[model samples]
Target: MNDLQWYRLYSDSEPIVEKELLNKLLSNGALAKFALVRHNGEYKAMLYVNGKRINGPALPEPLTTPNGEVTHWMGNKPGVGLTTSEAEMIIQAVTDRIERAR
Candidate 1:
């Protein structure tokens, strides 16, 4: 997947907040800045540049909760919402969902 492409979204309405989110995620190497354009009224999720979405929002389960959130795998700690086996299942689910949605 070395040839992987990236996707990103930004809106002036959320400058401060979006910038903070981008900074935090970037530090962890999950994504990077690719393009910045005006999309004032468009709500878009960053889709796969190759037209494929990642296997999961795979968002951390606890983070998916109210306001508590954490990203990244710490030493031996895996983030919420996925275990080794669960990740495989999520991978399948994500692919299935995206395929149907598209």
Candidate 2:
């Protein structure tokens, strides 16, 4: 068993948004395949990609449903995150490598 790398994501959106973000990250090699795990109402999405565990970012805002209904309660502090440009840089680098490899 290997320890997963932890990434903290902050957003004022629904879990589905977080999930979508995770999916994007996975497709971009920022993450691998993952599992959605919940404990005490806290959702922890984990994945092992390239011998690294990429833990999905946590949601900071309350999660709402597609109908705009609140589904889950987010914590008071959603915390800060790396700039989008920084994340995109990583994504692009990985995507480039993947493209070249393919």
Q: Estimate each model's TM-score.
A: 0.24, 0.26
Best by lDDT: 2
User: Model 2 segments beyond 4 Å from truth?
Assistant: 1-54, 57-80
Residue 23 displacement in candidate 2 (angstroms) = 22
**Candidate 1 residue-wise lDDT, 1-102, digit = tens:** 233322233324431111111111333444322111123333222212222232223222322333222322211121222233433333444445446556
On the 0 to 100 scale, the lDDT of residue 53 in model 1 is: 30
> Least accurate stretch of 10 residues (summed lDDT) in model 1?
15-24
Across 1-102, the per-residue lDDT of candidate 2 in tens digits comes to 233322223221223212322322332444333333332334443333543443445322223332233233222222123234434543454345445545
What is the overall TM-score of model 2 with all chains considered together? 0.26
Which portions of model 1 miss their true places by more than 4 Å? 1-78
Give the Å shift of residue 13 in candidate 2: 33
